[model samples]
Target chain A: MVPISYYLILAAVLFSIGVLSFLLKRNVVTVFMSIELMLNAVNLTFVAFAHRWQAVSPQAVSGQIFVFFVMVVAAAEAAVGLAIIISIFRTRQTLNIDQINLMKN
Target chain B: MQLALFIIFAALAVAGALNFLLQRHPINSALSLVVVMLSLAVLYWSLGAEFLAAAQVIVYSGAVMVLFVFVVMLLNAGEEERTTGSRAAYFAGIPGAAAVFCLLSFVFLSESKTLGSSNLGGYLNDGTVNIVEISKILFTRLLLPFEVTSILILVAILGAVVLARKEPDPKVVTSSTDAAGVIVIKEKV
Candidate 1:
């Protein structure tokens, strides 16, 4: 059996990678992707804990339920997020996050 | 057996990430992310999170990724010009990545020591876990978050619609049907 710790560690690593990517990448779309990666990492950890504890004593399905909800939010986020990205491109002719300096000042 | 499957899924996820990082085209990166999501689904399945695995595939691979791809296509995001930051900033990422790895290792080691093996009650009853029991506990305990999630989805939809709406031309909307139609204005090349 693969230990639950393994999954948790993997999730943490993936989340960190996502964070790093989000920081390093200058493209708006890539940053959006990095955010998705971070969310998925959280879902992985949630499911890992749920699987581990659910077998022993049936306390609650908190983790699994959380994952479900996160997925729902992610879907809605993607829908609106991409639409906005397209609109931004239409207006600015650029998809670079760095070029979005108007919001900074 | 299970460990092998876990390793395979992990490899797939990592590979997808690597590909996404290196790929030039935005659309390709979006597609690779879909692969990563599928591998996560498999991982969830192996962990006995059947419902979660299914939802992962359906919600992520099916819905979110498609939207991502659509945006990539619609924006026509090409290779971006790489701006070299200062040498200090470039080198800083190395230590940052290492620090993150160490933190993850520490958490995993500590958690493994504290978590004890619990008896697999009804999950092992019929060689498959009961989905009903899972839902019951979810609805009962995590009901508030569940409702909030729905609201969040609604907000995302509304935000996307609002953001994507073009600056309406007063002359363009002559009718109700035209009002609903989105005018795709071509950026002056």
Candidate 2:
């Protein structure tokens, strides 16, 4: 048996790494990927918690269901977000976040 | 055995994440993310989420990552140039993320006694198929949300198509004087 706390800790570490990449990365696509990573970490946490609760009540699979919804939403987000990124790239001609500052002016 | 598998996959996931962060090119980062997703799918299986594990591989590693790679190739996204990033991000963001991780770990550790331990395939031992159990809930109690997600995906597809369509090129017009002294204009699409 693996301690559920260990899984939670791993999820936290992955999430922190996601945040670090989101903040430090210059490219828009990399930042978007880090967001996906963060979502994945959260999904792992949900699955871990669901497994912990499954030992008590077998019917308690809502966490997994929530993870399912999250995956769906993530898929939708990735589609729309990548399209927006494509449009931004078409107009800006560069993928660097720093250089795509049209709204600042 | 469960503990060993958990540790190995957890280490793989973390290493893939770090590689994603350290990679300069979008394609490398995208591939690293695939590694992370695949390992996460394995973890999901270990946790007894067999359906989610399959979905994680198919949807996340398959569909989402393919989309990312396609966009990267379409745009010809090159290696990220090393720039002196904002001082605030370096000084605050890194420590802030570290602090968040520390806090979350502390909380989970303090509650470890209640969290309990999970056996590998613990939910599968009762002879109920994992997919059937999930579908029972998903189709009955969760049907509304499931249907709603279909609509959401539809909207997302429409939005992506509209947003990604190329703009029409503006027509160029040239005015010339003929021998008759009348102005004639020719327009090129």
Candidate 3:
């Protein structure tokens, strides 16, 4: 059996990658994709803990429930976020975050 | 067998992430993100969170990703030249990612031997947990965060609708210049 640490480590790595992508990417869509990556990383950690302590106790279900909430939030976020992106694209003809500066020095 | 599964998932996740990051097209990036979500769903199932695995697929891959794809289609956003941020940003991001990996590796190496040392009693069979039970805890114990999430989603929905809703202005496009123009606009509509 693979150890729980392996899964945790994988989660952490993915999360970091997501953060890097989010930070560096200027396109709004790519930034959104990075957010998806971060969410997936959290899901990975939840499942890892869920499996690590699968004793049919509260701890077992906690991770799953958290993942459930994460899904719900992701759904709502995508709905609204994508709509906003579309509107922005319609007006500006671009999704470049850097060029969309409303307030800058 | 578990190792093989882990390797497969890890590869899929990495490939998907790269696809998402490297693609210039928003539609392609959204598609890649879907692939990533599916791979994570599989990983969730492997970790015995069957309900979570299903939710990951249905909610994220099915619903959320589809929304992303739909919006991309509606907006008709074309590919743009990639933004290579400042050299300082490049330097900072790479080291930041590397440092995170190093930290995670340190934790993994330190805890690897200790993981299977302690048995977690027994594995959950039948592979299902009571949603009602979990909901009770969530509502009672996690009420604040739960309400906050709801509010966030609500705000997001309203914001999207307000932003996307357009009052069509006749002046945005001028009167048809030629019979050809009318035909083309008709076709587009």
Candidate 4:
């Protein structure tokens, strides 16, 4: 049997990397991808805990179910986020985050 | 055996995530993200979340990332210019992150003996937790949140369409007379 800690450690490592990218990357899309990475890391942790809790109760599958909703919400967020990114790119004529400073122009 | 499988996939996932972060072009980052998602799906399967594994692949890798790639192409998102932030941040940033990673891993290792020490082959012992069971629980207990999610997606679609579309010409608005009885001259293009 594989230890649950191994999965958790992996998630933690992945999440730290996600944070690093989120802070370091300049392109809005790259930063956005890092957010996805962070979400994936969280999903891994949830599944690990879900696996551990499977022995206790009837609601053994709750973690998995939550992961389902997280994915749905991520999809919606990506749609709106990318649309905003594209809109910014159109008006500002640049995808660089430093340039898109105006609130309404 | 389970340890081996987990190690391999986890390594792949981390490598993919690194590639996504390091790549300059948005397209390359998007592709690496796909790799990360696929490996995570495999990890979910190993954890016996069969339905979640499938959903992770289908929705995240298939749909969400495809949208990312689409927008990357549509916007012509180019390589990120290296920001010349303070020299102190560039020097301290990575080491700071490494410190955080070390701290977190230290905590995880300390807890490993208590939390991680579970027997393998749990799925073989416990009857399969399949799609039907997940759906049964979801439809009954989680019904409201599911409905709310549907509405959220609908709003996202509307918002995306509205935000991305070009606005009507300002000259067209000028053609109509104002209520204050002011003469609004229609400029000839």
Task: Name the 10 consecutive residues with the lowest summed lDDT in model 3 chain B.
Answer: B117-126
Cα lDDT tens digits for candidate 3, B13-47: 87888777777788888888888888887777777
Model 1, B26-130: lDDT tens digits are 788788889888999988877667788888888898888887887777776788668653355457875787688788879787878665332222144555465
> What interface RMSD does every candidate have?
2.7, 0.9, 3.0, 2.0
**DockQ of each candidate, alpha-carbon based:** 0.55, 0.83, 0.50, 0.67
Over 4 Å off in model 2, which ranges?
A: B171-189
Cα lDDT of model 3 by residue, A1-105, tens digit? 667787788788788879887877777877887898898898888767766655445444677777878787877777777777777777777788877765665
**TM-score versus the correct structure, for each prediction:** 0.84, 0.93, 0.80, 0.89
Between 1 and 3, whose TM-score is larger?
Answer: 1
B134-165: candidate 2 lDDT, tens digit per residue: 89999998899899999999999999999999
lDDT of each residue in A11-75, candidate 2, tens digit only:
99999999999999999999999999999999999999999888888878889999999999999
lDDT of 1 at B161: 77
Give candidate 3's whole-model lDDT. Answer: 0.74
Instruction: Output the worst ten-in-a-row residue range by lDDT, candidate 1 chain A.
Output: A53-62
| Candidate that scores best on TM-score | 2
Clashes of each: 1, 0, 0, 1
lDDT measured at residue B147 in model 1 versus the true structure, 0 to 100 = 80
Which interface RMSD does candidate 4 score?
A: 2.0
Candidate 1: pairs in clash: A80-B160
Q: List the global CA lDDT of all models.
A: 0.76, 0.94, 0.74, 0.83
